[model samples]
Target: MTGMERLSLRVSEMINHPIAQLRRSVTIHKLDTDGDREWEEVMGVLSETDELDMTINDDGTITLKWEMVADEYRQVEADEFEPEEEPVPF
Candidate 1:
């Protein structure tokens, strides 16, 4: 599976109820170009800021971790809306 898909699946499985915060640990296939790129795409979808925890494992895989809080999710949603480029008749 692609890195983005794998991460999405894991996060989906992790959530069992409503949550105000969550910590996600995603494993990246560091040696594979496609896998690495997929993880980059996944990173764009997460709410993490300029900081995240990364670890290199003996098994050669890289682990990326970040936490998401309710406030961050709200900000992400708010940022998704843009004002109309032009005025419209209401």
Candidate 2:
């Protein structure tokens, strides 16, 4: 699986229980395009900045909140929207 997917899955597992206190420890490993391997270690408390919410407009536009900020976060323009694409099974 991709690094982003792995991190997301781990975080989801940690927060599955409503009253579960997430551990402050987490790590993500991946390889760069140039074939360099790297890892990131999370060592602090993670506070929720926003609640997860999504809105779908009648015109096929969508807005997702609380998406992690990282290099992998891609932005698609309005003109490039693909209506035929299948929705991800979140």
Candidate 3:
């Protein structure tokens, strides 16, 4: 195989690895940009590799670090319904 092709295959294996079942101890280096510059560091256990290390450096940014947990897949509960409003006389 060609050199380029060999390299590509290796990368593909590392990324799309089927045996790459969810492994604990997944670290994430989050970097956010919204309000003032700030950072929140935390660790989490996840399966797929996170791309937190790939953050952009700039002002007005906030970074949150946390591992992806099965809880992340939890469904959000619906809020209680509100009563209909009556129309006011014109």
Each prediction's TM-score versus the true structure: 0.34, 0.25, 0.25
- Give lDDT: candidate 2, residue 32: 42
Q: Local error of candidate 3 at 66, Å?
A: 10
- Judge candidate 3 at residue 10 and give its lDDT: 44
Model 1 C-alpha lDDT per residue in residues 1-90, reported as the tens digit of each score: 866677656544443224312445655543344465665665455435454576668996656666775788888888898665786768
- Count of clashing residue pairs in every prediction: 0, 0, 2
lDDT of predicted model 3:
0.34
RMSD in Å for all candidates? 10.7, 18.2, 16.7
lDDT of 3 at 29: 32
Which candidate comes out best when scored by lDDT? 1
Residue lDDT tens for model 2, 56-79:
456533233344334323434444
Against the reference, the lDDT scores of all candidates come to 0.57, 0.38, 0.34
- Model 3, 1-90: lDDT tens digits are 754444445433443444332441122233332112222211221122364332323752323233444554442222234456789978
> Over 4 Å off in model 2, which ranges?
18-48, 51-90
Over all chains combined, what TM-score does candidate 1 have? 0.34
Better of 1 and 2 by lDDT: 1
State the weakest 10-residue window (summed lDDT) of model 2: 36-45
